[model samples]
Target: MGEVTTSLQRPVTNTGRSKLVRHVDSFEIQPPAPPSHNGVPRSAWARARRRVSRWHRPYITLLLLLDFAAAAVASLIAIETFDQSRAGFYNAEQDPTWFHTVAFGLLPLGWLVSLWANRAYDRRYLGLGPDEYKRVIRAGVAVAATVSFLAFATKTDLSRYTVGTALLAALLLILLNRMLCRFVLHVVRRNISQAGHRMVLIGTLPECLEVYTAVTRNPAAGLMPVAIHVTDGYAAAKGIETPVPVYAGRDVLALVREVGGDTIAVCGSASSEPGELRRLAWQLEGSGVDLVVAPQLTDIAGPRVHIRPIEGLPLLHVEEPTLSGPALLAKNLMDRVAAGFGLLLLAPVFLFIAIAIRISDPGPVFFRQPRVGHEGRTFRVWKFRTMYVNAEDRLASLVDRNETDGMLFKMKEDPRVFPVGRFLRASSLDELPQLINVLKGEMSLVGPRPLPADDGDFLGDVRRRLLVRPGMTGLWQVSGRSDLSWDEAVRLDLYYVDNWSLAYDLSILWRTVGVVLARKGAY
Candidate 1:
C-alpha cells in the first residue's frame, strides 16, 4: 500500500482512481511561494500574478468598447456622406425621427452580437494570426446580409449606400483598432513580469523542445513555459538543457499543480492514447487550467483541419490541398487585376529605374533568368538589372563567399553587384519587374518563390512548391529573405502550400509592405 495525501478533501493516490497517477522516481517540486517584502509576507502575490496573467476578460472588454465606438463613428460618417450626396432628394424633407434613433442604436448592438456569435472574442483566436480578423469580417458580412434581408422583406425605407458604407467603415476601423490593441499588448507583455499564462509542457524531450521554441518565438501568444514534464526514461536516455526546469513524470495533473502552471501543453508524443487524454481532462475539471494538445500534423493550417466527435470518439479530418477550386480561381483573378493596375500606376517609376540602371552601367534594363515555375515548367523570371553584366562569370569565384545555405547563393556585399544594385536589393525595388511575370500568368501576386531551374534536382518532395505559380513576393521574401536558412525557407514555403487562403495572402501582402519599409533581413 502506498501512502496517500488529501488535497481539497479528495484523496490523491498513485493508482486505483479515476485519474491514473503512475509515479516515477523523480523528486517532486513545489510551486513558487510568495517572498517577504519589507516585513510583509505576501502569499497573495502569487495568486494576483496568476490573475493578471489571464488577460482574456480585460482584453475582450477593451475590444468590445472599441467595436461599439467604431460602429457609432462609422454610422455617423455614412449618414453624413449620404446626406451630402442626396442633398435635394425627396427623403431630405422627412425629418429625423424614431426610425433614425432606432437604427443608430440597433446597428451597433447587432454588430456586437454578431461578433460574439462568431466567437471573435474567443481567447484561442486572439493575439495570433489572421483568425480574429477573419471572424470579424464574417460577423460584419452576417450583419450586412441580415440587414439587407430585413429591409427587402419588410419594405423599410433604408439607404443601401449608407448601410454598405457604414459596414465597410466599421470593418476597417475594427481591424485597425484590434491591431493597435495587439501592439500595445505585445509591448506590455515584453516589459511586464509574469505577463503571460504559466504553462507546463508534457512530452518527450524533442517534442517539448519544439513546443518551447514555438511558444517563446511568439511571446505575444501569451504562453510562457514555466517547466517541462518529460516522459519516463527520456531525461536519463538523452539529456538536454532548457531555460526551464525539466522533470520526468507520468502524472500530468500533479506536475501542473506542483509547477503552478495555469496551462498544460501536451505534445504529440505525450498522450498517445485518447482515453488517457480524456481522463486527464476529467481530472483537470475545476482546476482553472487549460489543456492544449499539439497534434502530429506539421505545416497544416487551421482551415484544413476539422474535428468530429462521434460516439464519444474524436476523429480528425484533413482536407487535401487543391489549387483548382473557386477560391484559387478568385485568387488568380485578383492577381491579374492587381498586377496590371500596379504596372500601370508605377510605369513612371519603371522608366526612372530603367534610366538609373542605364546610367549606372551599360547593361539591359531588365535581367532574365530561367526559373522553375508551376508544374515544374521553366520560365524566364525577370527583374531590374541589379548586377554587373559579368556577374554570372564572377559567380564561381564568389562561391566560397556565399552567405546563404544549400542551393541558394547570397552575398551581402558582392563585388559583382553595382552601387545601384545594392540600393535596389536593399529596398526590394529590383523585384518590381516581376509584376510583369504575374500579369503574364507565369506567376501570382502571392505564392512560393520560383527557384533557379538548375536547383530542381535537389527539391525532392519539395517540388510540391510548383503546384501553384511562383510569386513576386512570398513567405520567403516577407519572412527573412536572404537571412533565412534553407530549411526555414522550405518550411515556410510548404506551410504556405499546405494552407493557402485569400485572407492569408492579403495578410502576407500587408506584412510585406512593413518588412520592406523596415528593411529587415534584406541584402
Candidate 2:
C-alpha cells in the first residue's frame, strides 16, 4: 500500500520529469511578453507620447486664440466706424438690430473663414517672409467681394459707403494685429534654445553648408540645423566645418532619429534620387517629421514660380521678368503723384535743409551726379549736398579708408564732410533732393539704387537693374545701404528687378520709413 502511494505521486519515468523541465525552460526563454499596462503594449504608449510632444500645441493654440480675438475686435471697430461714417455722410435706412447681427456676427465669421481658406495662419508662412501679410490682404479682398455680391443679391439697401468703410477698417485692423503678432514672433525666434525646428540636413557638403549658413543667419526663418548627413564626400574635402555633428550614411531616417531632428531638409536634387526621396517621404508620413526639399534655384520668389505637373514630373515654370506693363505705368503714375505731393508738403523742411547746407559751407546747396538710369541711360541724380566743394577731389584720398564694400565708396567719418554735412548724411536728409528726380521721371519712388556712371563694373546680368528707373529709396537703402556686402546688394537688386510689383514697392517704401528712423547702415 505504501509503494503504490509513492508511485502515484512520483513521475512514471525520466520522460515526465524532462517534459516538465522543458516546459519551465520554454517559459524562461520566450521574451517576457512586451511590458503591458492594462493589456496595452509599452511600445504603443511610447509612440503616443512622442507624437503628442512633437505637436507645437502651445504656439498654435495661442496664435489661433489671438487671431479670433483680433477678428472680434476688428468687427467691433468696423461696426463703430461704419456707424460714425454713415451718420456723417449719406442718409440710409438705419436698422441697428439687423446691422449689428450681420456686422459683428456674420461678417467676422465670414472673414475668419476667408483667412483660413487663404492659409493666413499656416505654420510655414507665419513669422517668415511676406506670405502671411499677402494672405491677409487676399482674404480681405475676397471678403469685400463676397459682401458686395451678397448686398447686390439680397437687394438690401445697404449703404455702399458703410460697407466700404467697414471693410477698409476691418482690413487695416487685421493687418495691424498680424504685424504686432509678427513682431512678437520675431522676438521669440531670436533665441536659438527657445525657437525653431530642429533640422537634419541631407546633401552634399557644399550644398548643405550653404543651406546651414542661411538658416543660421535668418533665425526668424525657424529652421535650426542639428546634424548634417554628407552624401557625396567628407566635409573636410569641401572645407566645411559646422558646429553640428556630421553623419555619413544612406539611412537618413535612422540618422534623423539619432539626432532628434523634427525636420529633414534635402539640399538640391543630388542629395537623393527621386525614388529614394519618394520612399523617404512615405516613411516620414505619420512619423511627425517634416521634409523640405530645397530646389537648386535660389533667390526666386513664389509669384514667379509655378509648378506644372506633367507625366509624373513636376516642371517648374518660371515666368520671365517683366520690366514694363500696366504695373510699371501704375508705378510711374504713383511716383509722379507722390513726388509732387511730397515736394509740396516738405517745401518748408527742404528750404531749411538747403539754407543749413549753404550756411555750413560756401558750396552749392545741391549735388547732381551723373548716374546710370533705366536702360543704361545717363541721368543727373540730385541730392542735398552733404560734402565740401572739394569732396570729389578728396574721394581719392578717402578711397583707402572706405568702410563699405569695394563696389560702393562709403566713409562714416570723412574729412570732406562738414559738420552740417555729417548730420545730413546721418539723418539721410541729403536724399531729400531726389524727390525732384522722381518728379522729373528720371527716378522712381522705389527701384534698384542708381549706380554712378563711373561705376561701370555693373554690366552683364547686373545691368538688369537698369530695366527700371533708379529710385530715391530702394531695397539697397532699406536693407543695409553701405553695410551690405557687394554680393548681397547685387542679389537684392536682382531680386527686385526679377519680381517688381506695386505691392512690393509699397512694402519697401513702408519699411524705408522704419529703416531711416533707426538710422541703420546710414553713411
Candidate 3:
C-alpha cells in the first residue's frame, strides 16, 4: 500500500447495490466449457496435497529438532565456560553443580517453548521471507528477559556471562540453521515439480490468470496452481486459454474436495453472491485447505499498508513514500561512505582490471555515459569499459538482434564486447566504477537504475522513478537484470521508489550479493 496514485481514473461501476460492490458484473463474454478430466486424474491432485503435507511436517519436525540442538549446544558451551561452582544459586542452598545441571537441562526446553510461543515454528513463515528470522530474534529476546526476571526475583547469584553467551550463541545458531534448511528446501522445490501446495484458483479468467502467472514466476513460493474455478458470471467468458485445468460451478466446496486442493486462492473479482466468501469460509472450517484472498492491489509492500477495521470492515490504508527528509539524508550519507570505502578497499583489484583492459584494448579504462538522475537531471555515470572502442558504431547493425524488449537495446552475445569484456559484464565487474558516481551524489546504492538519456523521455507514472537518485544496483539488477521485460523492470523500480526503507535497502543489498555471484540474467 505504498501511496498508489494512478493516472487512469477509476471507472464508474454500479455502486447502487451497497457501499461495497461484491457481486460479479454480467458480461457478454462466454468462457469455454470445463475440459475433460482424463488428462489429470483426481487422485493426482490428492497425492500432490498429501505429498506436500508429508514433506512439510518432516521439515517442521527437523526444524524443531535443530532448534533444540542449537539451544542445547549453546547451553553446554555456556555451562563449561562459566561454571556455576563459583556462582552459587540462592546463597548456596543447593549444590552448585546440581543446580547448574538442572538449569542446563531446562534451558533448551524453555527456549523451545519460547520459540513456539513466538510462532517461530509457524509453517506459514518457514522457508520464505524474513518473518521466520524476526520471530527467532523475538524469541531470543524473550528468553533473555525471562532469565533476567527469574534471577532478580529469586535474588539468585546467576552468572550474567553464562546467560548472555547462551542466548546470543543460541540465536545465531538457530538463524544459521534456518538458513541452511531454507536453502535445501528451495533447492528441492525447484528440482521437484510436485513439492508444493496444490492450489485451486477461483475468480474471473483474467484475474485467475494474473495470479497464476505471478505465483508460477516464483517457484520458491511453493503455490502450485492445480486448477482454476471461474466465477459464475465469467463461466461463459471466451477467447482465453488457461494453462491449468479450468472448471466452473456453484459447488466450489465440492470442486475443491474433488480435486483435493490444499489451498484456494480467491483472486480479484471473485464471486461474492451475498456472503459467498463467508459461506466458503464456513465450508472450509474443518477442511485442511487454506483460503487466500488476492486483492486487486499490485506492487504494494506490507509496510505501507495498514488494516483499519471500521465496523468490522477492513480498509487498507496506504502511506506516502519517504522521498525526502532525514531518511533521505541518511541514504545519501551511506552511499558516499560505502562508496568511498569500497573504492579504497578495491584499489588493487581496480588497478589490475585497468591494466588488463588497457593491454587488451586500446581505449580508455573507464566509460562515461550521460544518464538521467534525480529530478530528470543528467550526470556522467562512470563504469569500467566493457565494450570495444567501436562498440557504439556497431549498435545500428545489431538493432535487429536485440534480445530485450523496450527502448533499451541488449544483445546476449554482442560482437562489440571483447573477450575480457564478456567476463566483466557477466561478473558485473564493469559496475564497480559506479562507486565513483555514488560518491559524487549522482547515484544511490539502492534505488531505481538510471536510464541513458537516449532511451526516451519519462512521463506519467514512469516519471515517479526519478523522484529519487538512480542506483548502481536497484531492484531490477537483483531481480533479473536483462531477463526481465521493460514493463516488469519499470514496475519493480516504481515499487522500490514508493516503498523505500532502510530495511528494504539492506535486504536488496544482501540479495544483490547472491545475484552477482550467481551471474543470473547478466550479459
Candidate 4:
C-alpha cells in the first residue's frame, strides 16, 4: 500500500543523460537504502550487497553457459585439427573417440562447476563494470590448472593442445557474452523496473536535494518515492525540485508511517553522529522502514572499502588505489601490446584518413593541443583536426551559442567544423591520431580523457583523473563525449580511475563501437 510516482535506475546511455528520468537513488527525497553512509563509517558493503547480490548470479550463470559453448567448439576443433597434424609426427598424440569426446566435454563442465563453487554465481555482479570478469578469469585459470593436474595424475593423455585452445576460446566468448549481457540487461531493466519496490524519502532539506538529484537522474531502478521528510530548521527552504511531497519536522515519519514507506533515507551531514545514527536505524527498524544514510563521500568505489567487525564495532578500511606498482606493469604491457597491434592493423586506415583530411581542408591534418595527462603532466594530445585551422581563434564569436551546460561549448550546427570533419567527429574518426599518443606512453587504450589547460582549475576538485594515462576513447567518449555536463563528465572520469581493470577497458571499447555506430549524442 506504499505510494511513489517516479521510476528508478540510472540512464543506460549518454543520449538519455538529459531525459530527466527519475533518479535511481538521489538523496533529497530518496527512500532509506540499506545503510548507505559516506566517509568515516561507510556502510557501502550493505548498499552494494543490495545491488551486486541482484546481478552477480545472473552474470555468473551467463558465464557458465558461455564456458560450456566455447569449450564445445574448441574441443571439437582441437580434436579434429591438432590430432590430424600430430598424426605425421614420430610421437603422435592419442586420437579422440566418443569416449574421449565425452571426457573432453567434461573438462569445461568441471571448469564451470569450479567457477560456481568459487562464488561465481553470486547475484551482486550483474551489470557491474569489470571485477566480475576478472573473477571469472581467475576462476577459469584455477580450473584449467586443476584439469591439467588431473590429466597428469591419471594415465590419460589429455592433450595440452586441447586445453590451451579451449581456454582461449572460453575467454573470448565470455568477453563477448558479457558485453552483450550489459546491453540486453540495460534495456530490460529500464523497461521492467517501474513496477517494483515502493519507498519514501525523509531527510534534511539540503541533504534531500542531493538524494533527489541522484534518484531523479536514474529511473530504471524502479524506485517510486512516496514522500519526503524535511528537517525543522530547513523545512522553510524546501522549495526545491523533486516529484514527491515534502513533509516538515518529525511528522514526516508519521506521514511515511501512514503511506507505509519501505525505505527511510536520513541525510544529515553534521547532526547525525554515530549514536544518533544507530538510534535512527533502530527507529527505522521498528517502523518497518529500511534505513539508508547519505553522507558526502564522493568518488570512493565499493571495492576500495572493506568492512570488518572488531569486537562489537564495525570498522571500515580503505585501500590505496592501484595506479602504480603491479597494476601499472599490467597496464603498461597491455598498452604497448594493444597499441602496437592496433597501429599495425590500422596503418592503411591511417593513410586513408591522412589523405582524406588533406583533401578536405588545407590546414594541417594532425591537431596537437596541450592537454593535461597522467600525474598532472602536460602532453600534446594528437587528433585528426576536425575544425578549421583557425578554429581556436574563433571560439569567442561562438561562445554565446553553447547548447550544453555553460562549461562546454557546442552548436547543433557548428560553422567552424570543416564539412568532412562533422562526419569524422560524429563517427569518432577524428581521434585516430591518439594511437600515436599511446605509442608515446602519454595515453592508453582506455583511461580518462585529457583536459585542456584552461580546464586546469577544476582539477583541484578532481585530481584523481590524472592518476592514469589519457585515452583516445575513454568513458567520457563512449558515454557521450559532448553531451555530458561538466559534473557528469568528472563523475564518469573518476569512476573509471577509481575502478580500473582490463575487462572494464575492454567493455568500454566494445561499447565504443556501438556508440560510434549508433551516433548517439556524438554530434
lDDT of each: 0.78, 0.74, 0.80, 0.66
> What tens digits encode model 3's per-residue C-alpha lDDT throughout 304-382?
8898999877788988888889988888899999999999999999999999899889999999998999999999999
lDDT for 373 (candidate 2) = 90
Tens digit per residue, CA lDDT, model 4, 143-222: 77886777678755455665576666666676677667666766765776533235656556566667767654555444
What TM-score should be assigned to candidate 4?
A: 0.67
Q: How accurate is candidate 3 locally (lDDT)?
A: 0.80
On residues 1-523, what C-alpha lDDT tens digit does candidate 1 reach at each position?
1111112212344465533333333333333222312323335443223322468778999999999889878887887787733421226446655545544677888889999999999877887777888899999999889888887897766767777888899899989988998888877777773447798888776787788887786566778888777775433424455678776533566567776788888887777865667767766655567888987777788888899989977888999986788999999999999999999999999999999999999979999999989998899998999899999998999999999885778888888889998899889999999999999999998999998997645457578888888998788888888888888888888888888889889988998998999888877
Candidate 2: misplaced stretches above 4 Å?
Answer: 1-56, 78-110, 138-168, 191-193, 233-239
Worst 10 residues of 3 by lDDT: 1-10
Using lDDT, give the best candidate's number: 3
Q: For residues 309-344, could you state the per-residue lDDT of candidate 2 as single tens digits?
A: 999888889898877788889999999999999999
Ranking by TM-score: 3, 1, 2, 4
Clashing residue pairs, backbone N/CA/C < 3 A, model 1? none
Candidate 3 C-alpha error for residue 422, in Å? 1.6
Listed in order, each prediction's TM-score against the native is 0.82, 0.80, 0.86, 0.67
